[model samples]
Target: MARPSQLSPIAEFARRHDPDRFLCALFAPPERRDALFALIAYNHELARAREAAKTPLIALMRLQWWRDAVAQAAEGLPARRHEVAAPLHAAIAAGALDPADLLALADAREVEAEEEGMPTREAFAAYLRGTAGGFAVAAGRLLGAAPALLPALQRAGAAYGLAGVLRSVRSLAGQGRCLLPQDALDATGLTPAAVVQAPEAARPVLAALAGESLATLDETRTTLRPLGRLAVAAALPAVLARRDLRRLSRGKTVSLDPRSLGDRLAVTLAGFTGRI
Candidate 1:
């Protein structure tokens, strides 16, 4: 086991790669911030596994390693000696965090490895629920959110997750992947290849996706309003989603950069105001 002093590396990784969640962690109770960062950093590791792996077999193996590590940590056994795992083990052992939620997150990434576009809208929603929604539920637990608030957190996470997918459409297309559903492409008279080759022509398809995301975001905010400050804080990233959707609607390019000054200011205000 690592001494508490050694957890800085995990925090640093979260700060560098997941700045939005890293900023959100600052609004968490000081004692819980490190554990929150560990969870988010662990998410980053799993979410990027496909890109990091040259082969599907390698990605599967990497995900399996995380699955086994989470199971071991849940049983109070030792975990592998890696930066994210060590701190993740510490967080899980501390209670509040759930190994099942982490396992579901790892499982969700398999979709990225095996498929280019989701077959249906429901399938995409499920993917977001498992990955992003699961993370919010876990983070909310760490913040002592009540059971009633879980659904609200899941909705907020789904909205935020969908927005993230929309914002990354161009980049995902560049990677030879398209997260847009096949039905959506068909409706727009576009194809997966066209999304990558003719992004301008595909703007309407992206805009419709953004519209759905905005509606979900509205619902999330309404659901979380009665849950109080901590719940609102947990859903702060929805503010960025709303902003991105607005940009997409106006024919402006969505900025996926986490470190943008406008994003920083918007997130900071939402954190202080406890509204998204």
Candidate 2:
């Protein structure tokens, strides 16, 4: 195992690409942190499918390749020898992750790659259930969380994921993508294309979505109280998510990262107190 302060290749990949989860992984036990790092890197690859591919078809192909890698890891066969795949395979092979949950994330990223926008709030929630919720379930498993905690983790994760989506509204719009519900946009005289054309105009809609996310996070407080140290550590991102969601609730755009010492201190306290 790498020393607590040392960075391994997979850990470095996660640190560079998925800073939120990377920081959370630091709170894990040293011996298990590498597996968490592997999981985070694999999740990053899944989340980046749209950004990295030239065509939706190409993106689906990349997701399919990851699916195949997960299958191979589950079967104890050798992975295809990629940097992220190799350690990710070991994680799955060692029973630190569930193949089904990982596959669900890949499935959601497929929609992310293929769909233009969500047709309704229900559709958006379902997509998040698969991607963020599924990811939290897998991460909780890695932390040795009891099965009873999985459902709550899913809820917390989905709420956090919504905050992330809300935070990225301007940037996603700039990329010609809008994740807000089409029905809501239409009611507000905005279309997905319009959101992309003028992201600033969508602040009210984004604030509404942020309010919903905050509500969801608030619901998790009772469930989150059951978290032990490792589980609390795993759910620490909710601290920052809540912070951003509150800002978004007020119709203000915020950075994906606040880049403040307060962010770390908040997470540390949330982890230490077993509350999110």
Candidate 3:
């Protein structure tokens, strides 16, 4: 187990790369916050595996390392020396995190790395469920969420994840990745090349996807309302999702700028209100 002081690196990593989750972790019980940070930091590491790797094979190797590390931790072995892995090992041991959930999240990232674009809305939703929805369920479980609430948490996560994908269309397009569903692109007479070459041509498709995301958010909000405060921490991403959806609906570029005053205010309000 890492000494309390040794966990600071994971905190710093979360604050730098995943500020939203860093803030969300703060809303957890003080004792559980470090574990939350560790879990999310691990998530950040997995999500960025491809970006950090020089090739698909390298990315797969990195992901396999995490998978092996998590398995080892589950078996009560020492964690690897890596910073994220150390804290993640501590979190899994302390929080009783499900190794299967973590492994499933890794698998989703591998699928993402192999794909150039989403083929259908259903496929996109499934991807979100595996990645973001899975994270929410795991985080909720770490915070002692009842088993019954897991499904709702997953729904909220899917909504938030889809919103994030919609917001990142322009940026992802630049990377030769298109998260927009093929059906939407076909309907809008837009292609992945068109999205990158001329983003304006895809506004209609983006707006439609944004609308779908908002509907999912609304459904999730309604479902989670019954769970009350127990769902708040897991649903925190919905704050940013709503903000981005609004901008997308207006045909404005969804900014990934984390320093925006509006984003901070939104997070703060969601934290205080215990909604979304």
Candidate 4:
């Protein structure tokens, strides 16, 4: 089981390794940072596979590769021999995280590939549990959090995933798709086609999503630990996300502009100070 030399250098770039992602990594033990890096890199790779593929089926095939790699790694095999897989396989051996979670994650990504538009609430929840929540739960074990924390981690992951979907609504709409729940949009007299074409017209939907984010934040309060920096780290992004949604609720649409340097610094400071 020798290590593989193939590493994804691009994943080492600052954006994915940026403060927020690093913040997430903080939950993992310092000794296991390399493993977490490999995991996050693999997650990014799985996500980008769709973008690289000529067809959705290709994306699904790539996802299956990752799932198989996870299984192989869990069984004391070399996984893929890639540099990322080396430390990742070691982590799997050490942590005893089930390979099924990895398979679930890949399967959920495949769902995104097959679906033409944003998922309904139920489908989105299922995806969150399998994908983001799966990662958080795995990370929780690495962080030495008790197993009970898995539910809390899942809730936090779902909240974050929902916020991401809401934020991407504008861009998704431009692609002739809308991520908003049909029921919610219907109540507001908005159609998926209309939202994609006239995102500004979906103000009500955006507002509702903003409110939902707030509720999720409140619901996760009991999960916070006294000095749980990871909890703070996880919640900080939600705060910024809520702020963004509030802006959208006001009038402005979701834009592709990067978060400001000041904002990143603010988040960094808040993360260090545990002020979030």
All candidates' lDDT scores? 0.80, 0.82, 0.78, 0.61
Off by over 4 Å in 1: 1-7
Q: Compared with the true structure, what per-residue lDDT tens digits does model 4 show for residues 1-276?
A: 012233234235313434355544553344555555656666666656666777778888888878778888877776576755665576678773556655666777776676444446676567666766666665555555566666776666556566566667777665555656666777888777888788778877777766766666665645644425644544445445555655655655655566767556656665666554
lDDT for model 3 comes to 0.78
TM-score of 4: 0.78
lDDT of 2 by residue, 118-186 (tens): 989899888887787788888888888888888888887887788888778888887778888898787
Give, for candidate 3, the lowest lDDT window spanning 10 residues.
1-10
Using TM-score as the yardstick, the better of models 2 and 3 is 2
TM-score of each: 0.92, 0.95, 0.91, 0.78
Query: Top TM-score: which candidate number?
Result: 2
Give candidate 3 misplaced runs (Cα > 4 Å): 1-7, 228-231
* Candidate 1 lDDT score at position 250: 67
**lDDT for each residue of candidate 3 in 1-276, tens digit (9 for 90 to 100):** 233355478777887788877776666766777777888888988988887887888889989999999999999998899988998998888755788889998998876667556778888778999888999998888887778878878877877777777777777767766767787799978777788776667888878877777766777777776555544677787777777887787778876776488787777777767766
Candidate 2, residue 261: Cα displacement in angstroms equals: 1.5
Clashing pairs in 4: 4-81
Best by lDDT: 2
